[model samples]
Target: MAPQLDTQTLGLVFQSRPDILAGIQQAADTPARTTLFNDIASFVYERLACADAPDGPASKRRRLDIAQPPAQTHRNGHAQDSVPPAGSQTGALGADAAVADPVLLEVKDISVTAPQRKKYDLCFTKNFLYARASGTSVPVQGIVYPWTDIEHAFYLPVPDKSQAQYNYVLLPRGSFLPTAKQASASAVDRQQPLEPLVFTVPATAPKPGSIGGSSAKTAEAVSDTYSSLFNWALTTSLRSAGNHSCQLVAADPKLFHSVARQPHRPNEKAVHVKAFRGSKDGFLFFLPTGILWAFKKPLLFLPLDRIVAVSYTNVLRTTFNMVVELDTEGSSDGSSTVEKEVEFGMIDQGDYQGIDDTYVRRHGLADRSMAEQRKAKRELVENAKKAPADGEGDASAAGGADGMTELERAQQEAEQRLQDEEDEMEEDYDPGSDGDSEGEGESSEDEDDDDDEDEEDEDEMGTAED
Candidate 1:
């Protein structure tokens, strides 16, 4: 069961992340509070662990310093807030200390609007990416994603919000931590796709000489964070296994030819193809890496290697839908491969030609159902080569004679016997047999005449005797 959020607990939570206080107040039920806390518990625990370290604030500051980008570090002047930026003992923090697992970059107060509406402070380390609740004085409960676990990261524009851009990270299905508190009987086992982690940067940098410039600083911080993740992904084991990298994907005309202007920014062209998944509306981005559906919950990223085919569905004069067939890690019950499909509907027909010519054809992802037919034909050829070795080739091929089923063979034998009896009857019928029938009729007539003469004589003798 989830922990109760009493006054003391709420105080600690607010102390950890003051921004969440508004969310807590907005939450009207117990389930909402449970979900809210569960989201940040991991981050909170990690923060508490670091704070309780025996070496004190010096060790913690060393760890945090590694995460700050160079620009942010200079602007804030670490000399005033933390220990000297010079050589420090990051090793005392223990086995996986900052020395070995140095933080590459960290961005605080990134606005996440999808999957859940909350703000997260993103920290990218050498081996992992961490997202903890924002506004926390000390890092605490948060989720961590290993560098290898991330399939790809996309930096895409938000629909209707022309000025803002958001970053989306895609992971494999079911890789996220489960939040269910009940047993299997009551727990729902429905699909739980790893909702992409979304965060955005300020549309424009802060006004010149603005106080703190937190928004502009966050924008730069987001850039540094993406760079750090990309560099780490380039060296991860996945790079060698399949060449998948976590680089940030943005609009490129070479990757997708169609570029249109937003309603608000008529002069500036952008690659923001609109589409829908179910009833929810979102935008589709065609990047050099793959296709990304963004600024919505259940964001989907389909990479080139996993894509089997792309087809247009529900096509109409004004609109069409794209169905993308993907390869999945098959079931454990001895099935080695499986296919899954996702359909993005209600796309404008005007963009169809551009999408078909640019991405689908270039990637060779167009309809490939004929490939299966060709495979079936090849199997037939192989079976023909292994046919039975006998003069009764046709019979064997038809599953007759040697290969005939029990019921079929019985029916064939019965038909053959009837044919033989008919042949015998035809052979026995001769033209001379008609003469023999005529002779037998003439003999019968002669015997009848003799019997009539004897009856007449017997009648004369009986008259004389009387």
Candidate 2:
């Protein structure tokens, strides 16, 4: 007797990919069948766990249809058809209202730095972190970061702002951005891509003497109280969620310090790079784990594991660009590897040596540009070895041309041949003059033939007289 597979899983596998299920069914042995079944089941589970495309009109209509029955059944209690009775509405909404998330940590008067600058009271709940408008207890309908989705947390310094820093959290790519359930429908409709959680503390503490300063001190104290708690909660959540890859990064000056110097804090070193991503000026922090670019919209964190190599480009006396090449997962069929690049430019040359020694060399991230040049040279040598002997003489003259790609040289040769043909046609073209000269030569030859004929006739007559 053979062990039976789960009927539900088998049915789902068959519905999703019949060929896969068929292969599982036609396995060579019992063990093979079990292995295939397990693999297919796992793949199907992961696929279903991923977020699906946005709900379509048909799905929305179906949901409306399903929701109408309960309301229609309770419509009799209502005096008007347009509005439902309070009891019915409360009953419909009570399911969600019954269980509220317990707040773990609450920080006040925090400001968002990226996407936009807005003041919000940051609340850390057991399952999520919500950013609500200041003095508002009600959760706003907007982006919420779930504890399980957060892959990393960083506490980094603000450039040129002494004793100022910000903390932000990053999510793994392809994860869905959670929305506050209590928020209104209008708020829910503003669905955007998963944005990084970017918030910064006030740069300066209020003076001790004023009333506003006292209030600011209170807010700062509240923020300080929960800062450590936030880190602990996030770490615990990551552990419980079995996300070993996730980390809580606190920038340590010992590992990799910023090359930029601060006159205010000459002894203290920051962990950041003053660089520009397009027109946006931002700071890059080289953490023990990876690099983080922040204080702007589209905040990016490149994990060390995902980074393939770091290469410098546009090298000059004043500034240069740094391009980070990232390794991406291949396609489902595993036919080819994928790569992605993020470039930050206008890095000061003054800070180059320190960064080169501390971050780039310490991490052993060799410059891929140099490697690529060497690879190109080796490829050229190999191509020369394989080149046919018939083009040996041309090859010497084509030394500079050999640097060009095969297609480019071929194109150049084609253009040159075309120009030569055009020049030959220009030299041969005598227009109507050549035609007139040929006509005169033909007339002279015809007159000469007539004279010869007359002479021959004269000779014949003389012979007859004799």
| Residues 1-466 of candidate 2: C-alpha lDDT, one tens digit per residue | 3433433334333543567657665672574465455555535433332211123655334334333433343222221223222112221211111113455455566667643468776665544566666654544433355555566677665667556555665543432121223655654453223456666754344223211222233344433333443455567656654556678888888877756678766777867768998899988888888888776656777777767788766654356678888766532212122336788898876566556667878888866756754332211111222345575644533434446643355467679999999999999987787556655556777899999999999999999999
* lDDT scores of the candidates, listed in order: 0.51, 0.54
lDDT of 2 at 60: 39
How well does each candidate superpose onto the true structure, as a TM-score?
0.47, 0.50
> lDDT winner among the candidates?
2
Give candidate 2 misplaced runs (Cα > 4 Å): 1-99, 175-193, 202-229, 236-244, 330-339, 372-466
* Best candidate, TM-score: 2
Cα miss at 25, model 1 (Å)?
47
Q: Model 1: clashing residue pairs?
A: 41-141, 42-141, 42-142, 43-140, 43-141, 43-142, 44-140, 44-141, 45-141, 47-139
Root mean square deviation (Cα) for candidate 2? 22.0
Candidate 2 clash pair list? none
Candidate 2 has its poorest 10 consecutive residues by lDDT at 90-99
